[model samples]
Target: MKRTRVALALAPFVLLTGCGGLSGGPPSAAPGTNAPPTVPRTATVTVTVSPSTPSASASPGSPGESKLGPPTSTREVTVRRTTDNPPLVLGVRFAKHDGFDRVVIDLSGGRPGYSAHWVPKLVQDGSGDPIDAPGGAYLQVTVTPANAHGETGSPTWVGGPVFHAGLGNVRSVVKTGDFEAVVGVGIVLDHRAAFRILEQRDPQRLVVDVAH
Candidate 1:
């Protein structure tokens, strides 16, 4: 536990007049009061994403959990740049929901910025343990329809959600013309409602409600 360069970058869709949820969340600061963590400085990128259809399914969470659902169309999303760190490029997005298919990641710029929490890796069928976080050095992932190209809609980004399936998960290294990013989503869904992080006054987001 000493790999904190902290940077998971992805920037493209920063309007925020008010965007509540899609599993892509970030907005809420109060209770214990939050917001005071933004650091970055490093660089690397060569990511890409193109979509249509391919794979989904991951069932593990009971040691530390994260689940959020509701998004039935949004494929092809990638962004990368990592190696020695701090240019902050690691954006990732994929959506589809009839049962499952959602992956969104964004860690931006650097100086010690962007730090998501969750760790445990290796599971593409080898069987078990899949969820990772490295620096906190930002993001790194690989998720497919689940069992290797199961679902089909055509377009193809090599299985839609797998982390390095064809490159493209939103990128970083800070040079999208200099800063202005937002992401605050914390989901855990499969039914059983109870996901909340609402702090209004001037902040609006972080909402995951699933239970049907």
Candidate 2:
């Protein structure tokens, strides 16, 4: 009876004492006091510039001029048909704009000698004038935040072609194709540009300028 009583008293002590060394060895060093909350990382962007070239000399389409001022009003652009067989253009998408806007084309199937030049009045200016870029084999898009389909601000041209600070919204120009080529202008101001050519299965995507 005495032994049983002694065991009962020591049993609690032993169990409590062993908790620290039981299933595992001695407890690990108290985890370094909780670390301070971590901070999120942010991306840093860089800007580079190149010499300015004659806006008219590149190709030809819209008149070369500054349309940076505020828009007097708003207007929509009309869809035009191309001569390519099987209709190379599947769909044309444009970004939302307050001053100048952009139209993007989704190709159904790429053609060798695909080229883009401004035709007739697709849209109008803020003053309600018919917009035209009639020149050369290529179409010259008069890039201004307010004039280009109600899009606001200038384009940041980047990548190998060139970036001219004098031209506010203009960013980069890219040409793609082995036998035949097409020129593309990257209007995305937030991204930087990169280009790559793939063989066989992978689709060859020519990124004019990506957001930085």
Number of the top-ranking candidate, with TM-score as the measure: 2
For model 1, what is the error of residue 155's alpha carbon versus the real structure, in angstroms, after optimal superposition? 24
For each candidate, what TM-score against the reference?
0.18, 0.18
Worst 10 residues of 2 by lDDT: 13-22
Cα lDDT tens digits for candidate 2, 154-200: 22221322222211222322211111112233232222111111111
State the TM-score for model 2. Answer: 0.18
In the range 81-145, model 1's lDDT, one tens digit per residue, is: 22222322234343443343334333332211122221232222223344232111222222111
Segments in model 2 whose C-alpha atoms lie over 4 Å from true places: 1-85, 93-104, 110-112, 116-129, 132-212
Candidate 2 lDDT (Cα, 0 to 1): 0.22
RMSD each, Å: 20.1, 26.9
